[model samples]
Target: MKDNKQLAGPRRDTIETFEGHENTILAIATFPDGERIATGSRDKTIRIWRLEDGRETKKWGVKMIIGALVISRDGKQVVSSEGPELGDDEDDDEDKVLSRFYQWQLWVRDAETGRVVAGPLDGHTNSVFALDVSLDGSILASGSADRRVILWDTTTWRRNGDPLLCGAPIACVRFSPAGHGQLGIATDKYIQIWALDRRERLAQIKGHTNYNGSCNLSLSWTRDGARLLSAGNNYDPVIRSWDTSTWEQVGDPWSGHDADQHIYRIILNPAGTLVASASSDNTVRLWQLSTGTEVARYEHSDDVLRVAFSVDGRFVFSGGLDKKISQWEIPDDLLTTARGDPLSGRLKIETTSFNSPHKHQRQASAARGKQKARVYISQSMYILTVNQNLKSHLVVCGFMITTSMFLRHF
Candidate 1:
């Protein structure tokens, strides 16, 4: 299972590459069937792909940059958290109103047609960074840079409650996957668990921070909803978890990921024993949840932004700054390798495959600080700016940004 199927080796294989995203891939969500996936890119389009042959199935052009994406449990809807493309001209009041119109909005689209069924579901005044569907598909929770968590009724696509205020910008939000009726709200230093039925914070666990203080970037819930894990950026380059039922710290912080690099996501496998982390260190690292051990790692050419496990837990798909979705099959002896010993995870693809030669050249140009591009929108005169650094490649045209636009993630 070498990177190239033809290569003669027993290493884990890179099975398929889902290509088509024109910009940095910001989000990826696996469909219920496990054979298809929906990915959101800074390209402002969500493309659905069939995993078998990496064929594009459907695409939806969105008005704003994608922040995060999640599919309803029933697989009938695709809900995406999108942020605004900032405008330069903000001196006039009329222009101000127009700018507010485009800021962080949520869109719920029909899974089959990719048509907007409901939204510009607006409530948060700032960029929405996270979105998660409840276990029953009845509640949709959104966390935002505005430092709030808002809930909406899936049945009516309407806000269900007032915003839950936090001390800092919310980096991620996830409903307990175990049907525990709890929502985990993550910020820089705290992971608060709220009881959905009571609409009150049930538990608040703090004190987990990385070298640079903290910037919690993502969260994951165990399949049984017993453990809630949180991840932060480079300075705080470690993953910490809590026992949901007791609201107590679970284990020693899991750390073999390179320091001073953002762990964009840390997704738990369906079995809930393995943790696959997508990192800015240009690699996807797998860890054992029970022992905090580095089991396997997949090398990527550029910063890895997102990671997702298939429904059946046999394959792992990752997408990122490379703009390509690389599918890696889990090693056959996932749990039995060296009797599940240390550093046995088996992916070794080094260079990333690009969709076009122009993409390769653009990246080279970017390294030399001469790369730039634009997306024309006849509706407004905002000029899109290409990100040229370690953070997300976001669009900041002439649109009005009230708070001087924050970094794409933090």
Candidate 2:
């Protein structure tokens, strides 16, 4: 066993690995205060940990595989999905209905005690893949493989209205950050913005192609609710942003990532100035929102599935296929350098569709010199340095990092 004091050393941009899950971690979420994190794993358990000291606070053993997880904004409740626990009960017909027909259940539990508070909220006829809570904590939205997005009234813990039929299997759903009654749904290769207040579809934004939308591809909204971001899939691996006001492509598609690097999720910082991308290429990259420049890249042990920015915009957390979670600290000097006049550069839209089309005013040469020397750590033993050139270069050398311990995978 390792000493607890050694694990609580100084904080840096180093890769700190937390190991507890016996299987792949499918979902991860941080509380609003960024002090605690909730993770659901295929190991059939949900565990909570403190951020300051890597200590497990609470854990709950679940019956079925956990597909997704979401915590309320007030940090009072947690919602998770558990597909039907299939079995060989030949006499039970409902078991056949659940196993063959894809019937699943959603559980609402107390965040502090891990006690069931409301569910087995039964309604969806298939596995639930996505879940989110409204900013006001009054409503909860869930998406399922049955091609439905259901809204629930948290006050009474009852279904609010008839299910919204998404044409394809629902991949992801989120409420707009503006706190209005709008919802963003991602299905197939398109993004549909729905106005929940009016109970109708608001707009369907098009232009990039993707294989399928069922991989928990994240859809993020800027804090002001002015724009939305979705990193394209294996078919189209570009990061696309949409102007919510007009629902049009914003400043063409941001592309520079290798074509083979399939993007899994994208997250915007709290300040709404930078976007972090998780990809299959075993790397995470941060892009400047205004200029669409790839600023930094952090490598991982395997394909990254989920990435999130801290509420305070100081650090980013990521977990994926490698069964590990990595936290990286953001440099204040780097953000200070990137923070500039959003209107300093004139933005232009491209008439062409899917093929990469982007245009932006060139950043001054002198500014690049001052923004150099931002370093990032990944899964490899070496270090990854992101210079002012806006490109990632890896150094293949190893060094000893004292006071850092790597937990056993098994």
Candidate 3:
């Protein structure tokens, strides 16, 4: 079952002023209070920004390109790790045998002061690609190219276990929102659930094939802590739901977008009503869980790399290949109604057509598909049908009308 609801919201201008990077921006993290945002760039620096004023808060120097950035649940600490650095063939002579190995480090800093608090966590034998902080804000879990997921005490900066080994580079790690000592870890082709108390694996979920050499897999837990969601870099993007009680797959995979697009990130809203994904196709898509259908798609000039929703669920922030951060406003009325009722009235327009060639005389129609439009009921819905070859001012006028209507209602 797929639910395609009309997204009613303002189309605000995207702020585009960040300096460009040589490579794609990999990850973004916001402070707990929502005032500050930090971005990990392949440019070898972590840029922190003041979201309210749209100003640079600070920039930290890192030696190599960063792969990920994570802020503690309490918002007091920030952690970042670098991607692997390639060694020159001349340096990798077998006879010379000069250690070709590279090590990744996790640097923890105070969020407010922008000062290093703990590391350069010098332990991972390979690039550290994924990181997560526990719900209680006591432990930090990181996954690395070393094929191990290590747990660290936030206060003591010590390893929690012998390092949970997955036999392949760990791509991502997430702490269950339930704060029940449950953690989810993703490697190249498998997802494993571990019990934090015993430091033992509870279950392993396997399905992905043709796993890319780059670690791009993502895993997240629903707010209720009853279901788990996982997605990764494959032709068929799989959004799987797992029952927490029985540790069983509850429903069929929610598949969308062709296999050609690489899904870089998948994030569930704090309320668990919506899931947002960023793709290499240069678009960010929002999906409603109840219907398993995309409700909105926001286009960008470059591939979207990271997206994060505010704790209140009213705004979505995305960072992309263009090296800029964009904030999207979600309609408050829609969010409120959707939470109260899983199925809200949505007005869906299907197959809009124009009756006349004359500009002002044209009449259009909409199918009102399945859901009644609830968020913007009183607002006008504008539809335009045009020929493929037509590139006149009329088309531009029609787009303007639609854009205006969306902003006014949202």
Best of the candidates, lDDT: 1
lDDT of 3 by residue, 1-410 (tens): 12233433223445434453556688888765546778888778788887667788788777778888998755677888874455534456764332323456888888777698887787787777788877556778988868888889887998876888887768789877554577888787677888887878888867344334323377767654667877767545556667777867777766664456667778887545778887766667777766666666676777787888754466688877877777776665546544553322233333234433222223433223331221111112322222211111111001112222321110
Judging by lDDT, tell me the better candidate of 1 and 2.
1
Residue by residue across 107-190, what tens digits does model 1's lDDT show?
899988988899878888777768887755678899887788998999999988777877777878887654446788888777
Clashing pairs in 3: 235-259, 345-372, 346-371, 346-372, 346-373, 347-372, 347-373
Tell me the tens digit of each residue's lDDT in model 2 across 1-410: 11122211123453455678787677888875457788887778888877777677898999877888998755678889877444535577875656644557889899999999998898988778788887556778998778889998987889988888877677789877554568888766568888786678888755354333323256887655678887676667778878888877788677755565577778777555788888776667788877777777666777887787655566788878888777887776646653432322111212222221101111111112222222222222111111121021211111111133111010
Q: Candidate 2, which segments miss by more than 4 Å at Cα?
A: 1-13, 84-101, 210-216, 338-410
What TM-score would candidate 3 get against the native? 0.74
Deviation of model 1 at 199, angstroms: 1.3
lDDT per prediction?
0.69, 0.65, 0.64
Candidate 3 CA-lDDT value = 0.64
Span of 10 residues, lowest total lDDT, candidate 1: 359-368
Residue 81 displacement (Å), model 2:
1.4
TM for every model, in the order presented, reads: 0.75, 0.74, 0.74
Total backbone clashes of candidate 3, pairs 3 or more residues apart or in separate chains: 7
Off by over 4 Å in 3: 1-22, 87-101, 209-216, 342-410
